[model samples]
Target: MSDRKSSGGAFLIAAFAMIPLLPVASCVSEGHAGGAAAKATGTETTSQPTHATYSCGPRGTLTVDNFRTSVKLVDPEGESVDLPASPATQQSRYGETPYALVLDGKEALYMKSGKEPVTCNR
Candidate 1:
């Protein structure tokens, strides 16, 4: 009876240990889905229309697309914002909040709502 109790306790401990991993697994699966969707949306090509994706923790994902004449940004909520390509720094307002995205080489700095800029790499 003692041995059985010990085995059951060990099993419970193991199960408890695995609880934290569940959320991590779900996040990884969600990230995979996001990647697949981004690719399907033409964000992984190497042509005239270039694309880039950045992960911003709780702020969510940021996708940038550079067309021949214009630039497009997609926020975490799948909302699209348009901006011109003339300036290296692009600023826009989403809803009532203002945001800025600065592109330098293969990196981008995203800032909004008085929060520190989030850096994203290509």
Candidate 2:
């Protein structure tokens, strides 16, 4: 009787262990629908866009709409631009020609063509 109880407990433990693998297995078998975009931009988006207004002190406030693969940036003067995700060794970065935004937690460093980099906080 004790042997049967141990076998049942082992089965139960194995069943619980497999639960965490279910989502990963489903994704593997079904494949990701946005896999191509994800690979191109190197961003896996699982939530909605985050909108924030960052205070840059002397440089003024910057309105940022951060998306999965792109970031829409509005300068203090109200000029707006959309930047795509760029590769970074650490921290999140988005760039488009004369504009680049690097986000580190609640702070962001904005760089443009003819201006100095501006540091802003959320």
Candidate 3:
């Protein structure tokens, strides 16, 4: 009789141990579905033009494109090459425009071929 009781207790402990695992398994499955859905929807976008900036160590110089989102880099001898974004684009909120380059962290240097960057704050 005591042997039967011990066997029943063992079964009960095993059942309890498995109960917690069920939720964990379900959570992992649901997380995978969410990730797949995000990928299939193609809902991601970026605000920066493809020509924002391209930094290749201290050797490459990026030439701004018409759209400002794409860039072509000039090599040491002035050879040009296209550059794609290293990482996927990130979302920017309301006040999130890329500022122009700064020499002393206080200058904005975004300008066109015949234009100059200006500061006009009231």
Candidate 4:
């Protein structure tokens, strides 16, 4: 019994760890008479990135809206900055100059022009 419980707990922990890596797929209906089963409901499936928030300690919080090809950052001042993926870099890096962001799974490295690089987590 104890062994079974440990296995179950391990599975739960692993599942939780994968939450950030999961892509959020949304299916939208055209509001037709049929609802995805009548063969004419007209459902469109779109994959959207999860909106993640990261705490940057004293620098304040950042809300991220990742769009696969690009990422939008909401700064502490409620300003939104959109950054396209850097094709030059192999990693999932974005932006340049005044703002640069590098994301690795659930953790992110944010760098600004005059400040030190800050590590952020969701």
Candidate 5:
């Protein structure tokens, strides 16, 4: 009967020891959704990066880096234009000329200040 009592005591101690870890285990299982809770509690969490590339017809290619929150366009002339993120487009201005990039379906549209829009495919 003493052995049974000792084992029961040990079990109770083990269960008590695990109580503090339950919150940590739950946080780990919540994944990114837990980040919202941390933020709500005034904790800071690092954001993940999202990078995407789009090929536009003859205009060139566009690369978006969500981490830096910037967009870069490469032209066939090997010139690169760094554009700022806009509400629904990436836009850049050089001298008096303005350029805009928009994505539709699997294609991208490149528009200059006054020229016709160029279509590019992925």
Candidate 6:
């Protein structure tokens, strides 16, 4: 019984570790959806380098009135990147939409509607 419990505990720990990595993909993909291009700017050690970490996965895909955004990547350390808002893109969407951010050297990307990031659909 003890052995089984240990195995279950180990499995739980492993599963939790994977949770953070999931978001990395969303941040990168979101940039592509809006026609905003992003490349690796550089890398920094520690979580403080970027403001927040965003990644691509089920939680990263966000949909609004006529547009959707996905996160394709984000820094492993949970850093945030800022992209300048494009007037043309916002106009097409009907208002001033927040720009998607990919941080941690493109390891994560996040889709933002305003101040908060839009959650992924699934």
Best by TM-score: 2
Better structure of 1 and 3 per lDDT: 1
TM-score of each: 0.42, 0.56, 0.22, 0.53, 0.38, 0.21
lDDT tens digits by residue: candidate 6, 31-98: 55443332221212222132333333644422222121222233222433323323223211111133
Instruction: Pick the lDDT winner.
Output: 2
The list of candidate 2 runs beyond 4 A from truth reads 1-49, 88-91
Which candidate do you rate higher for lDDT, 4 or 6? 4
What would the per-residue lDDT of candidate 4 be over residues 45-120, giving only the tens digit for each residue?
Answer: 1222358898877778888887756789887656789876654321346664576676766666765555555666
C-alpha root-mean-square deviation, each candidate: 17.5, 17.8, 23.9, 12.7, 23.6, 15.8
lDDT per residue, candidate 3, 1-122, as tens digits?
Answer: 99986775565445334433432443454465787547634533333343344343344333433222334433333545443321112121111122222111121122122222222111
Provide the global lDDT of candidate 1 against the true structure: 0.53
Off-target runs (Cα >4 Å) in candidate 1 are 1-49, 86-97, 113-116
lDDT of candidate 1 over 8-120, digit per residue (tens) = 55654554344334334444444658766465446323322377787766778889877634568886667687755333221211112355455555555554444444555
Please give the distance, in angstroms, between residue 16's alpha carbon in candidate 5 and its true position after superposition: 67
lDDT of 5 by residue, 45-118 (tens): 12212445667545566554432234566644455676554422212111113655444344445555434445
lDDT of 6 at 118: 30
- Number of the candidate with higher TM-score, 3 or 6: 3
Clashes by residue pair, model 3: 49-69, 50-69, 50-70, 51-68, 51-69, 51-70
lDDT of each: 0.53, 0.65, 0.33, 0.60, 0.46, 0.33
